[model samples]
Each structure stands twice: as C-alpha cells, then as structure tokens.
Target: MLKGRIIKALSGFYYVEHEGKLYETRARGKFRKTHETPLVGDIVSFQIENETGGYINEIHARKNSLMRPPVANIDQLLVTMSMKSPEFNYYLLDRFLAYGEAHDMEPVIVVTKTDLGNDVGKLEEIKNVYEGVYPIHFTDRNNINENLNDIFKDKLNVLSGQSGVGKSTLLNTLVPGLELHTAEISNALNRGKHTTRHVELVEVGGGFIADTPGFSTIEFSEIDKYNIKYCFPDFNAYSDDCKFRECSHINEPKCGVKSAVESGQLAKSRYDSYLAIHQEIDNRKERY
Candidate 1:
C-alpha cells in the first residue's frame, strides 16, 4: 500500500499525489457502510491497481476539517475582504474569523482593493479593530503585500471570502499562469458570480492553497451558544474577570468583556458580532 494526500475530488474520483506522481483512486466499499467520506486534503493509504489507478484502503487521522469547502487538515484560512466594491463589512469578516477559530484554523486577514479609493478613515478603523488581534495584510491588484509572501511556506492555506472580494484575482497574482476566472461585480446586485467550480490544491510559495467558491452566509450549526464565546479571540483578555465563571458576556453584571468594550479596550463591533452570532446559534437551537 502507498500513502498519499488527496489533491482534488471531482466526478466521484479523487486525485491523490504520492512522491510527485498523481494517482486516480476510489474509496473502499467499507467507507460507504461506515459513512466515511474522504475529503480533498485527506491523507489516505491506497492499494495500487495499475500504474496510475488505485483504491483508497484507509484514511489517516485529520487535525481539522471544514464542511463548507470540504477540505481537511487546513493550517490557515486566508480570509479575504474588499475595501470598496463589495464594501468592507466588519460583521461578515468577524463571522469568518469566528468560523475559522471554531474549527481550530488560524485566521489571517487580507484586505484588497487599496487602489480603488483612498479612504483613510475606513483603513484606520480596520487597523484599530484588528491590528494587534490578528495578522492583516493590505494589497491591490497591481501589488501583493510583501508580508503575505512568507506565511504560506510549509502550511496548507485556503483563500476564502464573499463574492467579488478578489479572491481569484489574488490567487492569480500569487501563482502566475493560474489565470483563474474573475468576473466584474454586477452593478445591480453588487455581487460577483461564483467562478471557481471545484476545490483543487494549487502549490504556491512551497505550500498548497485551495481557491474556494465565495460564499455570502456562514452557519454555526455545529456550535452551541455557550461555546460560541470561545471562538472570539478578542474576548479572551477580559472574559476571565467576569463575575460568574460561566458568564456568557451578555446581561451578566460585572462582565469583563462588556467592561472592556465600554472602556474602549475591546472594539464594540467585535462584541456586537459576538452577540449576533450567539443569537444566531440560539435561534437555530430553538427551531430544532
């Protein structure tokens, strides 16, 4: 048996790469009975049938996985956001950040479209909110940030964002000859079409990155309201001081998180996002 990592999954076939060679493989029938579906980033052991074809006999353990993109063992999530066209939405960005944090994936903030307009106030606001909390990179179509060049080495990264945020354009810039399809934002709807059809790990800067389809909504179906607070890293500093050990940071007196927000130590936008997501999870539970 040979061990390999799955690079792509299309038309019920998995393209696994082993020792610089690609193999077309199918999962064993036991996986169907066990309800184990292999993902794109799964490390699998397969038995070779011929020179290029095989059957995946076993799947190795995974450190992490994402349901939306259906990728496993991701190290970083390069969350892309725009400054003007789609208009930077803090709520949306926070949602993505929380989603990544919940899945144990490191979140890196990438802001694009600096050349579109010079909105110093908007830029400053972004920096004020997330500068120290997370790594943020600014770039435009003509120039990619220099800091971004160093993060991909030896780490599996995923580029993801809302529609029309220049994710494909950014990928094209990062990996030359990729020429991924990019569409102009619609004037009436103010959203770009989903140009990326499938998930394929493309190597870049000595690592692999999957350019995934842009999505507008994210759900917290897997997480509960009580556990959602841990997803917000910014809340950690003040959460310890809350009066109750189980304080949810809402309607609890002497809550450290609330105090930090009131004292300007924590951005209110982040706190508001926490409330919004907490409410979302609560509402989801109510319906069920």
Candidate 2:
C-alpha cells in the first residue's frame, strides 16, 4: 500500500497527493458501510491499481478537525474578518481564537477591507489587544496579498469567518484566479449570504487551505466551563497563581485570571468573553 493525503474531494473521487504527484482514487465499499466519509485533509493508505488509479485502504488518525468546514488535521486557522460591512468585532474573534485553541490549532487574525472602513483607531485597538498573544494582519483591496505567505506557510489552514466579512475575497487575493464568489451585506437582514458552498483544500504558498462557506455564528457545543480557561492563551501563566487550583474566575476570590482582568494585565474584552462563554456552557448543560 502507498501513503498519501487527500487534497480534494469532488464527485466521488479523492485526489491524493504523494511524492509531488496527485493520484485519482476512490474509497472502498466498506468505508460507506461504516459511514466513514473521507475528508479533504485525511492521510490514507492506498493501493495503486495502475498509473492513475487506486483504492484507499486505511485512514490515519487526525490531530483535530472542525465541524463547520469539515476539514481534518488542521495545523492552524486563518480567522479572516472585515473592518466594514459586517463590521469588525472583537468578541467574535475571541470566540474563534478560543475554539481553535480548544481544538489544538493555532489561530491567526486577518482583518480585511482596511481601505473601506478607514478606522485607524479601531485597527490599532484590535492590534494592541492581541499584539503579543496572536499574529494579526491587515489588508485592503489594492494590496491584499502582503505578508500573507509567512502566516500560512507549510500548514493546513482553514480559512473562515462570518458572512460579508470578506473571507472569499481575501482567499481570492491570496490565490489569484480562484474567483470565489463574493456577496454584499443584505440591508434588510444585515448579513451576507453564504458564498462558499463546500470545503475543498487548495494548495498555495506551500500550504493547504480550505475555504468554508461563510457562517453568521458558531456555538460552543464541545466546550465546557472547566476546560474553557485553557482555551485563552493569555491566562496560562497567571492561572497557576490563583487561590484555588481549579478556578473558573467568575466569583472565586484571589483568582489570578480575575486579578489580571482587574489590574489591566489582561484585556477586559477577553476576560468578558471568557465569562460569557463559561456562562453559555453552563447554560447549555443545564438545558440538556
């Protein structure tokens, strides 16, 4: 058997990449019986039937995967958002960051439509909050490709963000001739319609990127109160100094996370997001 990674899934074919060559293959009948769908990022063992065809015999375990885009073994997430139209939001970005961390994928922030909004103060504020914690990039129509190669180099990156936030536009900019469809925000609904319909891993700049259909919101189905704290990268060092060993930082006295929030050591927005997500998790658990 030969080892290769599935780079794309179209119709019923799995385009596997091995040794700089793409082989067109398909899964066996047993995979369907087991209800196992081969995702774009799956590494599989296959047998080459001839010069151009084969069958996937086995699938390797994945490090992490996202449900919305349905990509697997992702190294990082390029969280793209717009500065206008849908409007720049810190809370939404926080959610993306925390969720990516929870799934063991690094998150990089990309702010799009910079020239449209002309909000310098807002941009600076976004940068200042996440300056040391995460890498952030800004782009406009004229120069959307700047500094993008370093962010996505040699990683399986999932490109995602809310609708009308320019996820497709930025992707097309990074990979010219992609020609991904873009939509304007609906004045009546105040959101953009989904432009991307399915997820397919496209290779560029020595990396694999899957552009997902833009979504308006995401829920924390997997996260719980106890584990959400680890999702915030900024709280790692200070969490040990808390009065309690397993501090949630909501009402716990002398909690290091809370102290940082009070002393301005941590961004108030981030702490608030943590609190909100924690509450949401608790609320969700209570409902079920």
Query: Best lDDT goes to which candidate?
Result: 1
- Candidate whose TM-score is highest: 2
Q: Which stretches of candidate 1 lie over 4 Å from their true place?
A: 184-197
Could you give candidate 1's per-residue lDDT for residues 37-135 as a string of tens digits? 888899999988987678999999998887656789999988989998999999989999998888788999999999989999999999999998889
The whole-model C-alpha lDDT of candidate 2 against the native structure comes to 0.80
Candidate 2 per-residue lDDT over residues 29-123, each given as its tens digit: 89988888777799999999998789998889999876556678999877877888778877888888887888888989888888885777998
The per-residue C-alpha lDDT of model 1 at residue 196 equals 24
Worst 10 residues of 2 by lDDT: 187-196
**Candidate lDDT values, in order:** 0.86, 0.80
- Each candidate's number of clashing pairs is 0, 0
